[model samples]
Structures are given as structure tokens and as C-alpha cells.
Target: MSAEIIETLRSGRLANLGLLSDDDIQFAEATIKKIVNNGSETIRLVFPDQHGIFRGKTLSVHHLVSVAANGIGFPSSLLLKDTSHRTVFPIWQKQKDAPDYILEGALDVIACPDFRTCVDFNWASNSTLLICDLYQRNGAKIDFSSRQILKNATTSLQLAGYKALFGLEVEFQIFRIIDDALKHDQSQMPPTAIKTENITQGWQYLTETRYGEVEEILEELRQASETMNLGLISTEIEMGPSQFEFTFGVDEALTQADKFLLFRTMVKEICRRRQMHATFMAKPIMPNSAANGWHIHQSIIDLNSGLNAFMASTDLTETSVSSNWIAGLLHCARDCCLLTTPTVNGYKRYQPNQLAPTNVNWGYDNRGVMLRALIFDGDPNCRVENRVAESAANPYFAFASQIMSGLFGLENTLVLQPATINPYDVEATLLPRTLGEAISTFHNSAINRQFFGDDFVDYLTIIKKAEWDRYNSRVSQWEQDEYFNNF
Candidate 1:
């Protein structure tokens, strides 16, 4: 068993191992010394589910031998589900067609762990951690795997001789704990709370005093993040009261998504411990409060020469490859709306005077436009900023969609329309008006189906439709007041 485990670790096919028991850790150490004679007690196994949530069970160093003997088991339905915990697909329906199929049985899937993300599991009840990839019973890769999806998109770019780098700027609202009163009475109407600051106002944009007010909370968050190995860049006070923005250093797609999920979990847990609340809802409040957006900054690098592809030449005015990349992003703005601003509430942030883009356009260093080209002439590390995405978007899916759309643009040499002087007044293309409109556009888009694969496209659509139906079935206060009196 030790020999087999050592062979698997040395193969380099699996980068990380998971947490194990004390006995398992000892066995793994012996095996490692025998194989390479240099034992390192570390492993990481991570599995990202349909909602892009990382769920996994880790092993200790001694358990590596036993883990190699038999793979860990996880629920098969995790892949074929939606956010509501409903199984979106008819897995059993296919079994009837193929009598040999036996999916109703608790499907056993293998978790191929990655070693690169291996780190200490100090946050867990047990000291174990590992990042794993899902493989089918037949050893085929799971189609709905979020990591695989991002990997596929990145591979496509690599084939085109370019590598992509991702930076995430996430905004979320924080609320202080008050009485246990319901903010909304579902039986009647959702009540709104008036703004009253327990602390002083006028502290904005990383002000020293602002950090002082929230020092204890922010300090706890920073410590938790550091302990968990989450690469947090900085945190700042946002426009709304108690709203905050957290930034992280740029990384690969999968790593960035993993880090983002970790950050969210850390913030929520730490806030709960401190008797506070955090929400990523795009527009938690309407009429007055500022809307939150997740600004994704991405740059492509050349694999061969290790040069930034989005960089401009010494002469700034000359059109460079970076311009074409920005053009690609702007060209696919409308079609990519479903992935970026996914939820129904996300559209509320796209209003004309909301400081969010209402038109499909790009401009140099412009925040109003959907795409912002942030590269200067002779700057080798230039990149583009996509401001269209809402904070509620699934990072993996959103980033993957952008990669595919941008790749398509690059492949076809898509030309971008000139930057709008006034994006609000420009007669440029508009994003879908509603969830139904976005769904219809996505369903009808052959290009989208082709890139995302028909199975994935169909499954996602079905799940989204379920959510939409649920929302549509609900009665609103406006409907009650207008119709109850008249009819």
C-alpha cells in the first residue's frame, strides 16, 4: 500500500494529496521517503460543485497509503444540481434507456487531488486539506466540473499562443446586528430600514478613521484570511454605510475562484462570530444606496515569450494587439450578459445614472464603459477591466464565459465599435431587459451552446428556468394594492 501511494505521488499526474489520520500520515511519510527519499507532509484535495462551492474531505500524511488503496466517495448528484438543492437533470431517465446503466446506486466518483494548492487546514476541525478533481466511474472527466471548464477555456487560449491572468475586485455590504426583528414580513410587505449610523459618517475610501471604526472586524477578517492562505490584497470602505470592497492579487482562473470562495466564507464566518452580516446581493437597497459590482481585471500573456499580449507598443496611439482584445470583449458584451449579470436583481444595477454601464462599449481608462482598457503604450503588463459583471455572479462560470467570448473575438478578428463619448446617450446595443429575455437569448444563441456544450447549456437553462418560475409565481405588493382595490 505504501509503495502504491508513493508511486502515485511521484507520478506527477496528481499534484496534491488530502488530509489523513495520524496512522495514514505516518504511512505516507514512509512511502514518500522510500520513493523520493525526501518526504513532505502536505496534500490538498478540492472539489467545486455546481454552485461553484468548494466541498471536500481531506486526509492526513499517514492516510496517503490508505487513500491510494481506495479513493474517497462523494455524492454524485452534487454535479447535477442547482442552488436550491434540487437535482436539475433526469439522471434516472437515462438509466431506463440504457438498461446497463446503474446510476441510481450511490455513484462513486474518484477525487484526483492537486498538490499545488496543498496547504495547512488550520481552519478545519481536523488538520487536513487537499484539492481534488472529479472523475467518472469510467475515468472520464465530469462535464460540469467548474475547474475543468476553466481549464478547457484556458487550454483554448494557450492553443492560440496566449495565457490569461485574472484579478478580482469584489464588493459586498456589511450590516451591524440589531434586534432579532424581521426586516421583511413575507405575510405582508418587506419593510425597509432607515439609515442611522452607530458610528460617525464621512469615512470613505480606505480612510484611516474608517478602518479604525471597523478595526476589530477588519483585523479579524485579515487574520482569518491569512491563516487560510487566502491571498487578500486590501479592504476599503465602499460608498454605502458599512459597505466594503476586498481585492486580491491576480491568479489563474481556478485559483482565483477558489480564493474568492474562501474569502466569502471567511468574511461570513468572521462576521457571524463578531455579530455582523455580509451580503453580496447586487442591489440590496434601491432608490438611494449604492449598487455593488464585481470588477474583473484580466490580461493575456504570451506562453512562448512570457510577454503580456495586451501591452501596447512604445507609440501609444498605434493600435496594438491589446486593442483587439478589448474589442473582442466589447463585441461580446450583450451575449455575455447572462453569465456576468445572471440574477434578476442584477439588472437593477444597469440603470442609466447608476454609474454602471448601460451600453456595450469600451474606452481607454473609462469606468462608465462596459470594458475599460487599462494598458498604456510600452506597458508590458497591460490588461482590460470588465465592469459588466454583478457581485452575485458565479466566479468560475463568469470568468470562463468571458474567456470563451474573448477567444471567439480573437479568432474571428472581431472589430470593436468606437468608444462612446457618452455611453448613457449612445445608441449602442443593450443587455437583456429581464431574466426571461436573457434566457431566451442564451437558448437561441448557437454560439453559446457550441462553446459551453449542449449538455451544460441545457442543464443550466433548466435550473435557471426553475428559479425563474418560482420567482414569477410569487405575488408582489404592487399587484395586491392595484388589483385588490380595483377588482
Candidate 2:
């Protein structure tokens, strides 16, 4: 407790709290060297909130060691908020069902920078962004935090002698702003949607002319992605008006989540600075706008042999690893929709024949089905693409849903159903057609309760139901057209 002990370079609150390991301290020492060597003036500490939005504070490089050792603090309620930045939980009154740590006056949570995640954002020469791990004052992980959920799933996989590889196909739209919505009335919670026009005309899916017109901005995007080391695979003009897609190369589950969130933040910032708007909403409520789908490509690796589990010589069946995984996915697809399609707007992407899924089914290399198997002979890179999610889904939860469901299948030896040739006309169970349906399905799922636990599931469904309740309370245009006129 003496000043001399406290003044020691590595001794601080986080160290006394026994959260940061010696390796973490050593890593911090190395990071300080990097800041001095690279001349970074600011250190950005960030964590992905429940909705995958980056929230954090930037510190002067002079205090990097202290911040890294003692850890930066932020209000815990950041994770309890809904997408609209509204606190949905009853934090004021302690509930018997919820833990005191979460409801204790919205206490400060500690954010310790992960040295391995330290990266110099090239464009921001003066700043370094480090993804942090959130912990309680008692140094326990926040079980419902996006990173913790994904970590638990991955740990389960590792314990079972397997690993997960994940790749992402992200689709979003870019628009020319018609109004920035700076009026006083627009400054409400979450702000009003800004008015926008398409930067390009409709219906040119990857035509060179369309790419030619927007090549400059496209290059700008490509450069920023590459600079961030996001493992860029390819960028393409999507089927929708002014919509674009970017695919990332496969990586470990956690790394891919970080890259995905970073990409989302980067795209929006870069576009807004250029007097443009970039939207990752599942289906932006705009005329002629196409729904954006986030296709998750996943495969498993055996820890013993380090071989692709999906690369089997035998045909996919109940005995095949890939089959077991896919069967798990199909079994839980309906229940997990709340996580994979986490927004009221995301459900609109499920229309028939829109290159998005409406039914819970799988097919071999099929875009029409919910799960598309790409397993082929002699292909070590085979994976199944889950097209059930929208671009706005939180990558941590989305990836965890895959790991958790796949583990359930492997453990139970679940049998894969026959692949459907006609997904639109199949007798398969339907995906939840609306967010309300998703909430109900998720709330009632025993398997979800088992995997994510009752506490996390209830926390999520409660917030989503709040959103659904708000949506239903509002009078829609269709409701006005049908009821207001008819009544």
C-alpha cells in the first residue's frame, strides 16, 4: 500500500485486482515502445457493445502505461442499451432475476487493452486502436457481453478438440445525402434517418460501367480496408441499386469478429466524411433499395489432425462431421434468429426470391437455401455459408450461434436432412417471418436456454421485444391505408 510499491512501473489497480497477467504487462511494455517508435499521440481503447457498436475513449500516449495497467473505466449500462441507445433494463430497481453487479447503479466496468489487438490505423497516424476485454470490478467477465459469449462458445469447441474458421460476406449500400437531418427535431434518440439518394442508378450488377463511375470511392474503401489489415478478399457491385459487397478471407472466429466490426465503423466514417451515407441496415426503407444479407462462411478443424472436418471422402450423412454441423444449424435456425437477425428491419430481408432465405433448408452450393454447402472432392477450403443473417447482425453473436449450434449437433450426432432442390417451394419449416416471431421463438427455446443460459437469453429477448413493442405501437403506412381509411 506504500507509495513506493504503487509507484512501481507495473503495479496498478488492474495488477492488484489480479486481472492482468504478467504476460499482459509485458505486452503493455512492448506497446508503449511501439507508440514511442511510431510517434502515435493517442491510444484508442474500444470494446464492441451488445449491438456491435464500438464505444470507447482515446487516451494520450503519455498515459498509455497507466491506462493499460490500471485499465480504463466506462459505465456498465453501455451493454444494457438497445440499438436506439435507449437503456432497456430496469437498472434503477434491483430485480431478483438479474445479478446485482449488472444492476448496481450502472457501475463502471474495466476495459483492459489486449496487446495482441493493438494495430496502428494507418490513416490515423496519431492514433492506435486497441480492442479491450470488459471485466467487473471484481475482475469477472461480463457473461452477456458479445466478446464473452463468443469466447465461451469457442472455448467449448476447443475443449471438444475442434476449432472454428469463419469468413464474412458483407453487403451494404452507399448513398448521396439529400439531407444531413441537422434540424432540431431530428436530434432525438438515435437521431432521425438522414435523407439520401443513390449514388448510382439502378440494376447494374457488376457491370464495368458502374464500377468505372465509382472506382475512385471504391479504391478509397479498398485502401482503408487493406490498411486496417481486414483480410480483404474481394469487392463487388451488388445486385441492388448503389449496394456493394465485400468478402473477407477466413480466420479464427474472434479475429473475424473484430475485423467485421472495424470494417463497419470504417466504412461509415469514410463515407460520411465524403458527404455520403453508408448503411448496413438489413433492408433500408428506401424506394428500389435491396435488402443486405451477411453470409457467414464457416468450417471446423480437428485439433488432433488439424484437417478440415468437412473434407470427407464419404458423402455427407449422419456420420459425416459436416452433416452433423449442418443438421445442428437447421435444427436451431429458427430459434437463433433473434441473434442472427437482431433487428426489426432485418426480417424484411426474408422475402421469397430475393436471394435471401425464407425457409429453413440446406442445399449443395445453392443460393436458394439457407445453408449452402461448398464441400467438394479434394477441397480443403470447403465451408457452409449461412445466409440467414442480415448485414447488421452482431458478428460475435452470429459466430457464436454457429459454434454453439454446431457443437450441439456434434455432441448429439444429429442427422442432416435431405437437401432441398426447391427451397422456395419446399415443405421445410419457415424462418421467423418477423422480429416478433423471432423474439417469441428465441424466448421459448430450451436449447438456447441451455447454451446461452436463461439470464443472457432473457436479457436479449427483453430488449428485442421492447423494440418490437415500439414498432407495433406505431401506425405503419399499410395500417393507415387499411385501417384508417376502412374504419
Candidate 3:
């Protein structure tokens, strides 16, 4: 805020924060100046946590140049919090078991601007928002940060001479607000779930009239997505009450993940403004409620030939590279289930005959199997769509799991089984039935340890297990109804 502080920051205050390239430093300097000259009032410095939620600080325009130069400081405990806002790690103890944590006593973690990810938040009155990367005081990247983990996976693919492109077909629900818990006591850590009523009677399944009812809100979302560069392809009414699906065009895995989070946050904020509630929860507990799934369509590009690497030949006799990827996905699906469906509620969507995959199998353009191959012999757009993911997943972790698993299959030259015609009846392993099972599978996975390192795997397991423990401790209505009176 002071001239002396600005002068000190501009004169290399962030030089010791990390190893920023000259180009990056220059970009930050110029961007700050541009924002100042544009009369921007605020700058939001945000970082994606393990749950892919954006948490950060807002700076007055006067402090932009100084804060951008020095890097914004935030408590590292933000990364330690679970979905319930509980700090899972034992920070008070010696913490020798958790070495990755530098946040004992809630120490400061530096957040530096990712210059490439700067966006003007036009919906928020043109305030600039810069996505940040977390670092220790010594400049080491936070290994467990969801964005960094995704970057690691993408980098591995780059080294393997391939590029991954991902598209999204994510389904969610929207309802008219009945009541928002605004009482002081209701402002608990995770916040109380707001009560909502159906926007439509549903079950119409993409009918014209069903779409027309919510056309205005859908259009508003589509336009806002365009403003944020979300590459939206289509929006339609899904089968269940107040359910909707949105499709996005293909992009590199990292960019798609960022866009997906942004889209989710944007939709929720916009809907709230309209006195409606939009949720990406996999399966909201209601009578006859349909499950929401996030189907990711992916393909790899050959760096050498600049062609779709999955296409082996038009003859259709030999096994294509894509098949190997599918094999890997199936082989690793169980172990990686925690990454794709991280929450307890997510596992509830994987039910038989529910338009959600329950087994580890692939099929030719079949939606029932976990992996649906839409490959044509000569089509450049041929790709595989993974249907195992839930709408509530952190896109970064989910995409990272896909890349790592597929890479393993490709590298090992794994053989594929015949496509299953009846996905439910096939002799295949069922996916994990609960979050606890998924965490156990992930923890003991040799392939996961080999790729993600034991530290990363263990770090995830500890936090997720805490959530599971909380759930298990609760007394459910089902238990109460069956035992409360009878027992």
C-alpha cells in the first residue's frame, strides 16, 4: 500500500520465493501494470486444493504490484482440510509420520501467480483472477496439490511422446430453492445442505418441453461459459427430475481440468444468484432420483507423426494402440477408483442397470461397460470414453489417473479381452462398492505406488480414510428405522 513497499517488491522481493524464469517474472510485472492501468479494483489470487476447490486471498488493486511480486502467503492448512472442513493430519504431534506437511502450527505457504492461467472475472465486475501454485518457503512444489499431481501425469505423457486430449459429458442436478440454511448455527464447517424443490417433474429424458422449461437458465450458463472460455458443446435435460447434462469440446487434459472446475464454480454461483441450487453431487438422496455421471472421452496424439496414435490400421485385423489403453484402464480401474470417485456419495452411482458401469470391462460403443470404445477404422476422431467417473470428482485427479493408468497399459503392451456384450452379466470384477473399499484398493496397488509414489498415495489415503471414519461413525436413518423400535 505504501510507495516504499511497492518499491521494495518491484525490486525483486520474490527472487527468493522460487526459481521463476525471466519470462515469468517479466510477464507478472507487465500484467500487474496492465491491471493497475485498467482501473481494476481487486485481484483474487487462488489455488486449487486437493478437492479442486479454489481457495485464496483478495488483494486491493493498490497492493497488486507488491503482492504479485512478493507472492501471496496463505496458510498451508487449507490443503490439509477434508470435505467436512476437518484438518485430518495431526499437526500438534511430532508429525514425523506426515513429512510432506510444512504447515505445522499453520505456517505460511507461498502462492505465486500462474501467469498463463490469468483470467478476467467478468462476471465479478472485471476483477482479475490469477490461479496460483502452492510452494514451501524453499520453493518446492506441493506434491499432493491436485493441479501439481495432474501436471506430473501430463509431463510423463509428454516424455512418452504422446499428448492426451479429454472431452467432458458431465451430468448434474438443479432445483428451485426451498430454503437456504442462513441461521448462525447452520454455518458449520461444511455448511448445511440447502433444501430444494424440483424444477421439473423430470423423467422426460431430453424431451423438447422439458428443455424449454429451463432454457433460459441453460442459455445463461452457456453464455457465461463462453465468457470464461469453457468450450461448451451442448446442454440437454437428462432423465431424472431437475437433471441436466453438459458436453464440452476436447482439449489437452490439464486445460480441460481447469475449465471443468471453473465451469462447476461458475454454474453454482450463477444458480445461487437466481435463487436456484445446482449440484454436482453424484446421487442426491431422493425418491427415484437418477445418478449423475462424468463421462470422459479421451485420445492420445502421436508426437512424431502428428496423428491419432490409437489408430493402428484400417484393416481392423491387428490390435490397435487404443485397445492397449483400454486394457490398462480396466486393469487399473479398481485401484484408481478412489481417484475417479473420491467421495463416499460417488460410489452409490455405480449400480447395475442404472446407466452407470459396475464392472471393469470395455465395449464397442456400448454405454454399459466402464470403457466405451468409439473407434472407427479410419476416423481421426476415434476415441475411448471412460464412464466410471462421477460428476462430483476432482477433474485433475481423475484425469491424472486416466493418463497414468493408460500409459502403464501402453508401456506394458497389455492384451485386451473381447468386448463384453452384456456389461452387467459379464465375468468381470465389480468396481469398488464403497469409499472404504476404494481407499484400500488404492493403498495396496503396486502400480499406483510405482507411478504416484508411496508418499502421495499414503497422503491421499490418510485424508480419505478420515472421511470414511466419520461416515461409519454416524447413525443412519436406515439403521434407526430397522433397529431403533424393534431392538
By summed lDDT, the worst window of 10 consecutive residues in model 2 runs over 1-10
RMSD of each: 5.8, 2.4, 2.6
Candidate number of the best TM-score: 2
Q: Candidate 2 at residue 458, lDDT?
A: 84
- Give the higher-TM-score candidate: 1 or 3: 3
Most lDDT-accurate candidate: 2
Clashes of each: 24, 0, 0
Q: Write the per-residue lDDT of candidate 3 for residues 79-145, one digit (tens) a residue.
A: 7788998998876655644554564788888887776776667676757778887778778878778
Per-residue lDDT tens digits of candidate 1, residues 1-487?
A: 5555555544432223333344544454453444233243444356777665677765555665445444566777666655556665566556332222223554767776544455444443434455676776555666657777777888888899887889988888766666435456622322333332232253365677777888777777777778767778887877766778888888878888777776776577566566676767788753345688999999888788788876534222345566567666766666667778777788878888766888887777887878877777677657888989888787777888888878877787766566666767756788777777777777677777778786666666766776677668889888999999999
> Total clashes, candidate 2?
0
Model 2 agreement with the true structure over 1-487: per-residue lDDT tens digits: 2233234435787888887677777666766777668988888889999888899998888777778768889998897888878988888888665566887788899997887887766574578889998999888888988889999999999999899999999999999999999999999987998999998885989888998878888899999999889999998999889999999999999999999999998899889889999999999888988899999999999999999988864377547889999999999999898889999999988988888999999999999899999989889898999999999999999999999899998999999899888989757799998999999999999999999988888888877887888888888899888898688
**TM-score, structure 2 vs. true:** 0.96
The runs of at least 3 residues in candidate 2 whose Cα sits more than 4 Å from the true structure, single-residue gaps closed, are 1-9
TM-score of 1: 0.82
lDDT of 3: 0.85
Q: What is candidate 3's TM-score against the reference?
A: 0.94
